[model samples]
Target: MVYVNNVGQAIMQVDRWTTLAPGQARNSVRIESYAVFNKGLFILDVEAAPWGCGVWPAWWTVGPNWPWGGEIDILEGVHDNVHNAMTFHTQPGCSLPTPNPKTSLGPNSTGWIESTDCNAFANSNSGCQTVDTSQASYGTQFNVLKGGVFAMMWADDGIRIWFFHRAAIPEDLQENAPQPNNWGTPVAFLHNTLCPTSKIFYDHQMIFDITFCGDWAGTSYISSGCPGTCSQRVMTPSNFANASWTINSLQVYRSPQISGASLALPRPRSLMYLSAGLILLLLYI
Candidate 1:
């Protein structure tokens, strides 16, 4: 279910009123950028995000070949999480240093470090993670603030993520001159000192997806305090009324020195929208 609103915003939504069979998966949307990028500043202005039980929503970037090429999870969380989790998935050897100089634990950021090892095979593929402490960073609280901008700066040195509430957006960003240095304390930072981003991350495409009862969500469904099982929730049609993404815009600004593909706004015809009306059910298996 993908449609454009009267104001030109894209509304990628999940099926909210369809009762499914015992083994059926609910329909949802997962869209990706038309072009792959090497390095740039990407900003996503979101009006609403999918929330509630049995849903996992994320806005992230991924290189080729699973974890070998690296994956950067800029905005991600499952179920009724209040804070967004920023994570990095890479091959073994790339790790976030303890007492990281660029995380919330560091003097330069505001997100608390969750895991330091970025290896996709370690800790149930948890990756290196940092969690935003702000109550308005994810889920229902975020929508109450009418959403905001999630800015990601990917450079040769490192990657940094910042979330600005609708009322506190930086003036420079509004003026189209994004000076990340002037923005104080990012919510998440992955430096290159220990994690060789150049080798681990490359040719990444941006992604937005809403999946239900998958690995992350299904595995922790009971613990999330949702009623009944995750599969049972899928059969209940009313569990997904708010499971949608109302995106105002996604803007990408590339540096002349970055030596990557030219960044262009997604034209309506060029955008690839995928809405699986009959997706395979994925449980804790």
Candidate 2:
């Protein structure tokens, strides 16, 4: 889960997400998979943004079983979510196409597409979502304009997400060499001909979490009005003190057409289940 707090000399991989203070039944902090990807380009420069009223933060990508090694939530929403959806759970022969679901956008997309069957439970689970027209991009107005830039461009031939706000991020990803074709429009897009993005995606890993009531803030807490459940406002501790998640930097840029890993290929994690948050890049071109 990549959390080397007080290591001595050189390990350096800290996410420092905190929680478990306020009340007590809900706890927080979750960093799954240090780094693991089968594609390329995954960036996150969140400085701070996880609003209150029973928060349920997330950053996703999955593999290791469950839905046949596929699941990408990107950045979820909960509580008083003002925007930011981007989902994709899978298993049943992959799917897409809803409210203009196509790929390779770069003209500064606003983002739409509610759900178009990314399987997981077929329609009811409502995977395959995409909605982020920048209502500050999500929560507390995206931490008041201080946090932005989340780009994920996995490639077999499709999967793109771009959101740059902290002064319009793009300049080769602030000089880190992340081109992403000029970083224009792509609030979300999924292609690879609908399925077979390497047999429904694989080897994902990379997740940041802040759990609370559970299953999406106790099943949506009556759409954030707060009636009951969600374990009673997570055991009520001043309603989570504005939640947490304040990451400042993260970068994974690989894909000069594949490098040292030689072509990250491997399957059969016995039937994986811990799944996606996508961060294990070595995808050479």
Query: Top TM-score: which candidate number?
Result: 1
Which lDDT tens digits does candidate 1 get at residues 1-285?
776667777788898878999979888888776577777788777889898899999999999788878999988888899999999999998877565555437445688888889999999999988889898799999999999989887877778889999999988766655667677778877878888888889989778899998889999999999999999998877999888988876667765443212222222213222222211111001
Give the candidate number with the greatest lDDT.
Answer: 1
| Backbone clashes in model 1 | 0
Residues 194-267, candidate 2: write the lDDT tens digits: 76767788899877776665666767777778766566566655666556655555666555463211323122
User: Which 10 consecutive positions of candidate 1 have the poorest summed lDDT?
Assistant: 276-285
Instruction: Give candidate 2's whole-model lDDT.
Output: 0.65
**What residue runs in model 2 are displaced by over 4 Å at the alpha carbon?**
1-39, 43-53, 60-71, 74-87, 90-92, 95-123, 126-195, 198-215, 218-237, 252-256, 259-285
Model 1 stretches astray by more than 4 angstroms: 99-104, 258-285
Candidate 1: C-alpha RMSD to true structure equals: 6.3
Global fold similarity of model 1 (TM-score): 0.87
